[model samples]
Target: MHELTNETQGARYSPTSIRATWDGTGSVKDASRALGFSRAKGYDLVRRGEFPCRVLRIGRSTRVVTASLLRVLESGEPEYSGGHTGHCTS
Candidate 1:
Protein backbone atom coordinates (compact mmCIF):
# COMPACT_ATOMS: atom_id res chain seq x y z
CA MET A 1 0.00 0.00 0.00
CA HIS A 2 1.11 3.51 -0.73
CA GLU A 3 1.79 5.64 2.33
CA LEU A 4 -0.18 8.86 2.70
CA THR A 5 1.51 12.22 2.49
CA ASN A 6 0.26 15.78 2.81
CA GLU A 7 -0.02 16.00 -0.94
CA THR A 8 -2.13 12.86 -1.15
CA GLN A 9 -4.59 14.10 1.46
CA GLY A 10 -4.46 17.60 -0.11
CA ALA A 11 -3.55 20.88 1.53
CA ARG A 12 -1.55 19.08 4.27
CA TYR A 13 -4.04 19.49 7.10
CA SER A 14 -7.26 19.35 5.16
CA PRO A 15 -9.38 17.64 7.78
CA THR A 16 -12.34 16.94 5.55
CA SER A 17 -10.14 15.60 2.82
CA ILE A 18 -8.29 13.30 5.17
CA ARG A 19 -11.39 11.18 5.72
CA ALA A 20 -10.70 9.41 2.48
CA THR A 21 -7.75 7.58 3.98
CA TRP A 22 -9.44 6.66 7.24
CA ASP A 23 -11.10 3.30 7.77
CA GLY A 24 -12.30 1.98 11.15
CA THR A 25 -11.02 4.99 13.08
CA GLY A 26 -9.61 8.51 12.75
CA SER A 27 -7.98 11.23 14.76
CA VAL A 28 -9.75 14.04 16.60
CA LYS A 29 -8.66 16.50 13.94
CA ASP A 30 -10.20 14.46 11.14
CA ALA A 31 -13.41 13.89 13.07
CA SER A 32 -13.54 17.59 13.86
CA ARG A 33 -13.69 18.51 10.21
CA ALA A 34 -16.18 15.74 9.49
CA LEU A 35 -18.32 17.15 12.28
CA GLY A 36 -17.79 20.78 11.23
CA PHE A 37 -15.53 21.74 14.08
CA SER A 38 -12.35 23.76 14.17
CA ARG A 39 -9.34 21.87 15.53
CA ALA A 40 -9.16 23.77 18.80
CA LYS A 41 -12.89 23.53 19.31
CA GLY A 42 -12.71 19.82 18.69
CA TYR A 43 -10.10 19.33 21.39
CA ASP A 44 -12.13 21.51 23.74
CA LEU A 45 -15.22 19.46 23.13
CA VAL A 46 -13.29 16.31 23.79
CA ARG A 47 -12.09 17.74 27.06
CA ARG A 48 -15.61 18.74 28.08
CA GLY A 49 -17.06 15.38 27.04
CA GLU A 50 -19.32 17.17 24.61
CA PHE A 51 -17.78 16.19 21.31
CA PRO A 52 -20.98 14.45 20.08
CA CYS A 53 -19.15 11.12 19.95
CA ARG A 54 -16.83 8.95 21.88
CA VAL A 55 -13.18 9.96 22.08
CA LEU A 56 -11.07 6.99 23.00
CA ARG A 57 -7.65 7.50 24.51
CA ILE A 58 -5.18 5.00 23.10
CA GLY A 59 -1.84 5.37 24.81
CA ARG A 60 -0.64 8.88 23.94
CA SER A 61 -3.27 9.64 21.29
CA THR A 62 -7.05 9.82 20.80
CA ARG A 63 -9.32 8.55 18.07
CA VAL A 64 -12.96 8.53 17.02
CA VAL A 65 -14.87 5.52 15.82
CA THR A 66 -15.71 5.76 12.15
CA ALA A 67 -18.64 3.34 12.47
CA SER A 68 -20.39 5.56 14.97
CA LEU A 69 -19.86 8.53 12.72
CA LEU A 70 -21.42 6.64 9.86
CA ARG A 71 -24.41 5.74 12.00
CA VAL A 72 -25.05 9.40 12.73
CA LEU A 73 -24.68 10.26 9.08
CA GLU A 74 -26.91 7.47 7.84
CA SER A 75 -29.57 8.40 10.36
CA GLY A 76 -29.50 11.98 9.14
CA GLU A 77 -29.63 13.18 12.70
CA PRO A 78 -28.30 16.53 13.78
CA GLU A 79 -25.20 16.14 15.93
CA TYR A 80 -24.22 18.14 19.02
CA SER A 81 -27.66 19.69 19.14
CA GLY A 82 -29.34 19.89 22.52
CA GLY A 83 -32.03 17.56 21.18
CA HIS A 84 -29.73 14.60 21.28
CA THR A 85 -31.43 12.01 23.51
CA GLY A 86 -30.98 8.87 21.48
CA HIS A 87 -27.31 8.37 22.10
CA CYS A 88 -24.93 8.75 25.00
CA THR A 89 -21.22 9.47 25.01
CA SER A 90 -19.08 7.01 26.91
Candidate 2:
Protein backbone atom coordinates (compact mmCIF):
# COMPACT_ATOMS: atom_id res chain seq x y z
CA MET A 1 0.00 0.00 0.00
CA HIS A 2 1.12 3.53 -0.70
CA GLU A 3 0.57 6.53 1.51
CA LEU A 4 -1.72 9.16 0.04
CA THR A 5 -1.02 12.74 0.99
CA ASN A 6 -3.28 15.78 0.84
CA GLU A 7 -0.44 18.27 0.75
CA THR A 8 -2.40 20.57 -1.50
CA GLN A 9 -5.23 20.62 1.05
CA GLY A 10 -7.87 20.07 -1.61
CA ALA A 11 -6.22 17.17 -3.37
CA ARG A 12 -8.18 13.97 -2.94
CA TYR A 13 -5.52 11.41 -3.88
CA SER A 14 -1.81 11.40 -4.43
CA PRO A 15 -1.44 10.73 -8.12
CA THR A 16 2.02 9.29 -7.67
CA SER A 17 0.86 6.98 -4.93
CA ILE A 18 -2.13 5.82 -6.96
CA ARG A 19 0.08 5.23 -9.99
CA ALA A 20 2.41 3.17 -7.86
CA THR A 21 -0.29 1.20 -6.09
CA TRP A 22 -2.91 0.40 -8.75
CA ASP A 23 -2.66 -0.65 -12.36
CA GLY A 24 -6.02 -1.84 -13.78
CA THR A 25 -8.87 -1.41 -11.32
CA GLY A 26 -9.37 -0.82 -7.59
CA SER A 27 -12.09 -1.46 -5.04
CA VAL A 28 -14.69 1.23 -4.32
CA LYS A 29 -13.63 1.13 -0.69
CA ASP A 30 -10.04 1.89 -1.58
CA ALA A 31 -11.04 4.58 -4.03
CA SER A 32 -13.30 6.16 -1.44
CA ARG A 33 -10.53 6.13 1.11
CA ALA A 34 -8.28 7.83 -1.43
CA LEU A 35 -11.05 10.36 -2.00
CA GLY A 36 -11.25 11.09 1.75
CA PHE A 37 -14.67 9.58 2.23
CA SER A 38 -16.12 6.60 4.06
CA ARG A 39 -16.79 3.19 2.51
CA ALA A 40 -20.54 3.51 3.03
CA LYS A 41 -20.53 6.88 1.34
CA GLY A 42 -18.64 5.37 -1.55
CA TYR A 43 -21.29 2.71 -1.95
CA ASP A 44 -23.97 5.37 -1.70
CA LEU A 45 -22.33 7.34 -4.48
CA VAL A 46 -22.24 4.23 -6.64
CA ARG A 47 -25.79 3.32 -5.82
CA ARG A 48 -26.92 6.78 -6.86
CA GLY A 49 -24.68 6.84 -9.93
CA GLU A 50 -22.76 9.75 -8.48
CA PHE A 51 -19.30 8.25 -8.27
CA PRO A 52 -16.63 10.63 -9.50
CA CYS A 53 -15.01 8.06 -11.74
CA ARG A 54 -16.10 5.29 -14.03
CA VAL A 55 -17.59 2.32 -12.22
CA LEU A 56 -18.02 -1.21 -13.54
CA ARG A 57 -20.64 -3.55 -12.20
CA ILE A 58 -19.74 -7.16 -12.83
CA GLY A 59 -22.19 -9.66 -11.42
CA ARG A 60 -22.52 -8.57 -7.78
CA SER A 61 -19.10 -6.96 -7.68
CA THR A 62 -18.38 -3.29 -8.29
CA ARG A 63 -15.01 -2.01 -9.44
CA VAL A 64 -13.62 1.46 -9.93
CA VAL A 65 -11.59 2.05 -13.04
CA THR A 66 -7.98 2.77 -12.09
CA ALA A 67 -7.27 4.91 -15.13
CA SER A 68 -10.36 7.01 -14.51
CA LEU A 69 -9.43 7.36 -10.87
CA LEU A 70 -5.95 8.46 -11.81
CA ARG A 71 -7.24 10.86 -14.37
CA VAL A 72 -9.58 12.50 -11.87
CA LEU A 73 -6.88 12.71 -9.25
CA GLU A 74 -4.36 14.12 -11.68
CA SER A 75 -6.79 16.58 -13.20
CA GLY A 76 -8.28 17.64 -9.87
CA GLU A 77 -11.83 17.28 -11.16
CA PRO A 78 -14.58 14.72 -11.18
CA GLU A 79 -15.55 13.12 -14.48
CA TYR A 80 -19.15 12.93 -13.33
CA SER A 81 -21.10 15.55 -11.39
CA GLY A 82 -24.24 13.70 -10.49
CA GLY A 83 -24.95 15.85 -7.50
CA HIS A 84 -27.84 15.05 -5.25
CA THR A 85 -30.97 17.07 -5.76
CA GLY A 86 -32.82 15.47 -2.91
CA HIS A 87 -32.84 16.76 0.63
CA CYS A 88 -29.96 15.70 2.82
CA THR A 89 -31.11 13.55 5.67
CA SER A 90 -27.94 13.84 7.55
Candidate 3:
Protein backbone atom coordinates (compact mmCIF):
# COMPACT_ATOMS: atom_id res chain seq x y z
CA MET A 1 0.00 0.00 0.00
CA HIS A 2 1.33 3.44 -0.95
CA GLU A 3 0.79 6.53 1.15
CA LEU A 4 0.06 9.74 -0.76
CA THR A 5 0.11 13.10 0.92
CA ASN A 6 -2.27 15.95 0.42
CA GLU A 7 -0.03 18.89 -0.40
CA THR A 8 -1.94 21.51 1.52
CA GLN A 9 -3.07 19.49 4.53
CA GLY A 10 0.16 17.53 4.60
CA ALA A 11 -1.93 14.54 5.57
CA ARG A 12 -0.91 11.21 4.11
CA TYR A 13 -3.43 9.47 1.90
CA SER A 14 -3.38 6.81 -0.76
CA PRO A 15 -2.90 7.32 -4.47
CA THR A 16 -6.01 7.93 -6.56
CA SER A 17 -4.73 7.15 -10.04
CA ILE A 18 -5.81 3.66 -11.04
CA ARG A 19 -3.64 2.04 -13.66
CA ALA A 20 -5.09 -1.13 -15.11
CA THR A 21 -2.73 -4.01 -15.62
CA TRP A 22 -2.79 -6.60 -18.37
CA ASP A 23 -2.46 -9.40 -15.84
CA GLY A 24 -5.84 -8.54 -14.27
CA THR A 25 -4.69 -8.18 -10.68
CA GLY A 26 -5.51 -5.10 -8.60
CA SER A 27 -4.60 -3.79 -5.22
CA VAL A 28 -7.03 -2.21 -2.78
CA LYS A 29 -4.88 0.87 -2.77
CA ASP A 30 -5.16 1.24 -6.54
CA ALA A 31 -8.89 0.62 -6.55
CA SER A 32 -9.35 3.22 -3.85
CA ARG A 33 -7.39 5.69 -5.96
CA ALA A 34 -9.34 4.94 -9.15
CA LEU A 35 -12.64 5.36 -7.36
CA GLY A 36 -11.60 8.45 -5.40
CA PHE A 37 -12.37 6.71 -2.17
CA SER A 38 -10.65 6.80 1.17
CA ARG A 39 -9.07 3.64 2.48
CA ALA A 40 -11.69 3.32 5.19
CA LYS A 41 -14.43 4.10 2.67
CA GLY A 42 -13.10 1.49 0.28
CA TYR A 43 -13.27 -1.17 2.93
CA ASP A 44 -16.69 0.10 3.85
CA LEU A 45 -17.82 -0.40 0.27
CA VAL A 46 -16.77 -4.02 0.52
CA ARG A 47 -18.63 -4.51 3.76
CA ARG A 48 -21.71 -2.88 2.24
CA GLY A 49 -21.51 -5.22 -0.74
CA GLU A 50 -21.40 -2.30 -3.16
CA PHE A 51 -18.09 -3.12 -4.75
CA PRO A 52 -18.51 -5.42 -7.74
CA CYS A 53 -14.93 -6.56 -7.68
CA ARG A 54 -14.24 -10.17 -6.81
CA VAL A 55 -12.17 -10.64 -3.67
CA LEU A 56 -9.90 -13.53 -2.91
CA ARG A 57 -9.25 -14.21 0.73
CA ILE A 58 -6.00 -15.78 1.79
CA GLY A 59 -5.75 -16.18 5.51
CA ARG A 60 -6.57 -12.68 6.76
CA SER A 61 -5.70 -10.96 3.51
CA THR A 62 -8.04 -9.89 0.72
CA ARG A 63 -7.24 -9.29 -2.93
CA VAL A 64 -9.37 -7.70 -5.63
CA VAL A 65 -9.50 -8.84 -9.23
CA THR A 66 -8.69 -5.91 -11.52
CA ALA A 67 -10.83 -7.00 -14.46
CA SER A 68 -13.94 -7.31 -12.35
CA LEU A 69 -13.31 -3.90 -10.82
CA LEU A 70 -12.89 -2.33 -14.25
CA ARG A 71 -16.06 -3.98 -15.45
CA VAL A 72 -17.99 -2.48 -12.56
CA LEU A 73 -16.53 0.92 -13.28
CA GLU A 74 -17.61 0.66 -16.91
CA SER A 75 -20.99 -1.01 -16.39
CA GLY A 76 -22.94 2.08 -15.39
CA GLU A 77 -24.49 0.16 -12.58
CA PRO A 78 -26.22 1.88 -9.70
CA GLU A 79 -23.95 4.03 -7.61
CA TYR A 80 -22.96 2.61 -4.25
CA SER A 81 -25.65 4.18 -2.18
CA GLY A 82 -25.24 1.65 0.56
CA GLY A 83 -23.53 4.10 2.82
CA HIS A 84 -20.60 3.21 5.00
CA THR A 85 -22.83 1.92 7.76
CA GLY A 86 -24.58 -0.60 5.48
CA HIS A 87 -27.65 1.57 5.01
CA CYS A 88 -28.89 2.51 1.55
CA THR A 89 -28.42 6.23 1.06
CA SER A 90 -29.95 6.34 -2.39
Candidate 4:
Protein backbone atom coordinates (compact mmCIF):
# COMPACT_ATOMS: atom_id res chain seq x y z
CA MET A 1 0.00 0.00 0.00
CA HIS A 2 1.09 3.56 -0.62
CA GLU A 3 1.51 5.87 2.32
CA LEU A 4 0.88 9.62 2.49
CA THR A 5 3.94 11.78 2.72
CA ASN A 6 3.96 13.84 5.91
CA GLU A 7 5.04 16.93 4.06
CA THR A 8 2.21 16.85 1.50
CA GLN A 9 -0.40 14.70 3.21
CA GLY A 10 -0.91 13.27 -0.28
CA ALA A 11 -0.30 9.77 -1.52
CA ARG A 12 1.88 9.44 -4.57
CA TYR A 13 0.91 6.83 -7.13
CA SER A 14 3.45 6.17 -9.82
CA PRO A 15 2.34 5.66 -13.40
CA THR A 16 3.89 2.21 -13.35
CA SER A 17 1.98 1.26 -10.22
CA ILE A 18 -1.31 2.53 -11.65
CA ARG A 19 -0.79 0.80 -14.99
CA ALA A 20 0.15 -2.43 -13.26
CA THR A 21 -2.74 -2.31 -10.81
CA TRP A 22 -5.64 -1.04 -12.88
CA ASP A 23 -6.96 -1.57 -16.38
CA GLY A 24 -8.81 1.20 -18.24
CA THR A 25 -10.72 2.32 -15.18
CA GLY A 26 -10.98 1.92 -11.41
CA SER A 27 -13.48 2.54 -8.65
CA VAL A 28 -13.83 6.02 -7.21
CA LYS A 29 -12.86 4.61 -3.85
CA ASP A 30 -9.57 3.34 -5.18
CA ALA A 31 -8.85 6.60 -6.95
CA SER A 32 -9.63 8.53 -3.78
CA ARG A 33 -7.33 6.29 -1.80
CA ALA A 34 -4.58 6.93 -4.31
CA LEU A 35 -5.30 10.65 -4.00
CA GLY A 36 -5.15 10.45 -0.20
CA PHE A 37 -8.85 10.91 0.49
CA SER A 38 -11.65 8.83 1.97
CA ARG A 39 -14.16 6.70 0.05
CA ALA A 40 -17.02 8.92 1.13
CA LYS A 41 -15.15 11.99 -0.01
CA GLY A 42 -14.55 10.37 -3.34
CA TYR A 43 -18.25 9.78 -3.82
CA ASP A 44 -18.92 13.33 -2.72
CA LEU A 45 -16.48 14.70 -5.23
CA VAL A 46 -18.00 12.64 -7.99
CA ARG A 47 -21.43 13.83 -7.08
CA ARG A 48 -20.25 17.41 -7.09
CA GLY A 49 -18.35 16.97 -10.35
CA GLU A 50 -15.15 17.93 -8.67
CA PHE A 51 -13.15 14.74 -8.62
CA PRO A 52 -9.58 15.11 -9.72
CA CYS A 53 -10.05 12.80 -12.69
CA ARG A 54 -12.54 12.00 -15.40
CA VAL A 55 -15.44 9.86 -14.24
CA LEU A 56 -17.59 7.51 -16.23
CA ARG A 57 -21.16 6.78 -15.28
CA ILE A 58 -22.24 3.34 -16.36
CA GLY A 59 -25.80 2.61 -15.30
CA ARG A 60 -25.63 2.82 -11.53
CA SER A 61 -21.88 2.40 -11.20
CA THR A 62 -19.18 5.04 -11.48
CA ARG A 63 -15.64 4.45 -12.67
CA VAL A 64 -12.70 6.81 -12.60
CA VAL A 65 -10.58 6.95 -15.71
CA THR A 66 -7.18 5.39 -15.04
CA ALA A 67 -5.36 7.62 -17.50
CA SER A 68 -6.90 10.77 -16.08
CA LEU A 69 -6.03 9.68 -12.58
CA LEU A 70 -2.47 9.05 -13.67
CA ARG A 71 -2.27 12.49 -15.22
CA VAL A 72 -3.57 14.18 -12.09
CA LEU A 73 -1.11 12.24 -9.98
CA GLU A 74 1.75 13.21 -12.25
CA SER A 75 0.68 16.86 -12.34
CA GLY A 76 -0.30 17.04 -8.67
CA GLU A 77 -3.34 19.10 -9.54
CA PRO A 78 -6.98 18.24 -9.31
CA GLU A 79 -9.39 19.03 -12.11
CA TYR A 80 -10.69 21.80 -9.91
CA SER A 81 -7.71 23.38 -8.23
CA GLY A 82 -9.88 25.87 -6.31
CA GLY A 83 -6.85 28.06 -5.80
CA HIS A 84 -4.95 25.20 -4.24
CA THR A 85 -1.27 25.12 -5.07
CA GLY A 86 -0.91 21.37 -4.69
CA HIS A 87 1.15 21.90 -1.57
CA CYS A 88 0.54 21.38 2.11
CA THR A 89 1.43 24.14 4.51
CA SER A 90 2.57 23.43 7.98
Identify the candidate with maximal lDDT.
2
lDDT of each: 0.63, 0.77, 0.53, 0.76
Task: Tell me the lDDT of candidate 3.
Answer: 0.53
Candidates' RMSD to native: 6.8, 7.7, 8.7, 9.4
Per-prediction backbone clash count: 0, 0, 1, 0
Q: Tens digit of lDDT per residue, candidate 2, span 12-75?
A: 3577777776868889998988887889999999998889988778778989999988887778
Model 3 TM-score is 0.53
TM-score of 4: 0.72
By lDDT rank, best first, the candidates go 2, 4, 1, 3
**lDDT of candidate 3 over 33-89, digit per residue (tens):** 555567677777767666646654556675666656665666745343232355433
Q: How many backbone clashes does candidate 1 have?
A: 0
Stretches > 4 Å off in candidate 4: 1-13, 80-90
Query: Stretches of candidate 2 above 4 Å error?
Result: 1-13, 81-90
Question: What's each prediction's TM-score?
Answer: 0.59, 0.71, 0.53, 0.72
* Runs in model 1 lying further than 4 Å from the true structure: 1-20, 76-90
On a 0 to 100 scale, what is the lDDT of residue 75 in model 4? 95
Kindly report which residue pairs in candidate 4 clash with one another.
none
